[model samples]
Target: MKRPDTRAASVGVIDIGSNSVRLVVYQAMERSLVTVFNEKALCGLGREVQTTGLLAADAVDKALTALKRFRALCKVQKVGEVHAIATAACRDASNGPDFIAKAEKICGASIQILTGPEEARYSALGVISGIHKPDGIVGDLGGGSLELIDVRGHQVRSGVTLPLGSLALQDLAEKSLKKAQRIASEALTDLPQLLAGENRTFYAVGGTWRALARIHIIQSGYPLGVMHGYAIPAAEALAFVRRLRRLVAADMLADIEAIAEARRPLLAYAALVLEHVIRIARPTTVVFSTFGVREGLLYSKLPDTERAKDGLLCAAQDLNELLSRSAQHARELIDWTDRLFRVVHIRETEEERRLRHAACLLSDIGWRMHPDHRGEQTYGIVLNGNFGSISHEGRIFVALSVFFRYEGLRDETAPPPLTQQLSQAAIDRARVLGTAFRVAHLISAARPGVLPATHFRTQDRKLMLIFEHQMVDLVADRVGGRFKQLARLVGRSGSIVRS
Candidate 1:
């Protein structure tokens, strides 16, 4: 196994799935995978694989064409290495080996045909890479097969592959929904542990599942459009799946503008499969994971030390380094805020602390945007950013905090839908964190210099900001006013002193 080139300018991965062939170019960062370019061609390689046991001729042609273009794309993007992996369709198809040979020639890279368990393990690793402390069963439903693996933290348990994928089941059951459901349930019956992941999370992978999640997000008017950590209660998810199962093609196309027209055909089968899984597994939540086999391949190449880093923090740091005025200042902000929060006696749980750290690292990402649009831009960026390891609520908290930091406390432009999902306590804490950031920025101006030495202390039931005598010139009415606002939110009167 070749170690990932940490200094590689870019790395490309082509995922040849049952239904689609995608080429993703990622700027391989120190601790994060940032997508630079991604395009998918729906080749439907598994369209007739269940019955014919061979890759469709037209599908193979399309995939080959796509591969040629993707190879060119890698060259144009200056990608140092390109990894190509073919999943269920290629593994199950009789002509798969021939296709792989031709694909290797076209793409100028060897195509690795992943076995069922290998696919399951990679999908699980994808979940582990994107989620913090994931302890549940990961289900990756592709067009040809479904891969289920139990994952706890970074460890992967034995997984099973079922012939119950949407496309395969559609053909297996002759497009009968009831028969598909029965087949899925029966296929999963032997895996009692997988079916009995009660109250745990069921992480959904694969393009079909992501499309279903997108439909749900649009139908429900979800504020955040990102799907990496989109989670819904098991009951609501099951209900939504059931509703999707009953929806006609016209209705589905009309209701979900997020789903592409080509994907609409598989919606019902996807829903039917999901509904059966939900009924048996009874997970407390259904989480949509954007990471899958492709991401897992990248993750697997990383050194163990790099892989052990926190996913959310890695993303935050990457963003800071890429976009902020000074990544060092962001690190300083984290440390400075740590002292501020401790001095203010702000109680933060471990999760809250991690979110706060991420927010601090991301605080200055919007500096280059126009002043008027910075707040809105930051809000959208943080909310929809490719961050992993944080829940939807954590995303909301971080986005809102950064939004307030740039937009000020009195701005009425906050999106209500997102804010409403957060608790009052969470909202207040975010406000405090944001206000702290605002004050910090005012004093430091997002520069790489040392911040004015200051200490926060409680005196006579009031918040006192004591500045060093040498740093008194850095304090101003604007800085004091922001501090006072944070003080108010924390239910304390505020005063500033140069000592």
Candidate 2:
């Protein structure tokens, strides 16, 4: 007997952009797609397109070579399907069609050349797929063009694209920072998409913006280094980018190697574009997104039902299925906690409820680890997991709850530094949920069909855990003490009842 070849189920995307040629192979085409392989080559296909009006011969050769390598890598991975798309440089350069024709033959795949509007729409969809209930403008700056669109929730309004990408801007201004500023300002003047973005989020999507955000993260000493959903106040962001404009590329790279070497010189051009957009758009916050055209394209192909699923919960459910003692036990825990919260009058917002559900699914993931290290390990896993639709603050809350479940909610059981990102109210709530986990896990022993037989009730200012007759023997001193701790967190006494 032989094992099945599961690698054949993977899907891949090859993105031909102005500045970079990249390939990403995802685990599946489902709602919660995971990247199994990712690689990129900085080809600079649009480096001379702005001035020469043609793709540079060397740049074209570099892109085609990268594509050939990507195709072979996809074959080695046994990728079931591969979709190739080209943007900006390919569509604008006069020789772009000829280049695409050659590249297609080399990769053995038909390439879709996306127009500016199509690029804008896909970028907006990518933002919508990653951010929960996003209401903002999505601006994708590539090496040759910038796409701007307005999005609220799932709806994407009309969008506009401009020739303000870093490489293109540099070529247009002949490497003059002052001229780049003037060109960006002139190109973005009085755009309605930007006008509609006042006081809302400006979702920055592109490699350059991600590199810029990485710099911000390294400098701020932020606990979580995840780039997706990193946010900054518009005023503060303006000040930072303005400071960059005054410095040379060497100064910008001083003591900072977090950004790519190829991307360093373009930083000022990117900053200039951002500065002008912020000034005109008057957005309140700038959010950086790792998801962009590729993610958006995948999202566009999904059915509405799949698109409606909660990404965080979906990802968590996958983890629970893979690692839990019993996936059914996790589901029962969700319901049991639901009853407990209601009985104890623990109010939760809709978002908080979802976070709690995800935490329950992930609570037992560290059971396979050593007892001494389970808390720390699980905390780090959830804190840095490749999850979306949850903010950094929400991540801290969920992680802390699971941490308390293993480590025990005692004063001496100090939490990690990331907990500081959450509010005091949220921390208290996590402690309460974690204490509930402590009691529940003990009663059921990580098995299903035990929690449903038990329920919670309140009388005379005392929270009571009532167990059926068959489960009476499972109760003990430790259970009572843990229940008491949970009750105390909510300002109530604790008791256990057998019925």
RMSD per candidate (Å) reads 3.5, 1.5
lDDT of 1 by residue, 123-151 (tens): 99889999988999899999899998999
Candidate 2 lDDT over 1-499, as tens digits, reads: 9988654378899999999999999888878778889999999999999899999889888998898899889989888899999999999999999999999999899999999999999999988888888899999999999999999999999999999999999999999988888899889989999999999999999999888888778767776888888998999899988877777555747556687788888999999999999999999999998888998999899899999988889889988988999999999999999999999888999999999999999989999999999999999999888867777888889999999999986678777778878889998999899989999999999999999999899997999999999999998999998899899998899998999
Backbone Cα, N, C clashes tallied per candidate: 0, 0
List candidate 2 stretches off by more than 4 Å: 1-8, 249-255
TM-score of each: 0.93, 0.97
Q: How close is candidate 2 to the true structure, as a TM-score?
A: 0.97
Worst 10 residues of 1 by lDDT: 248-257
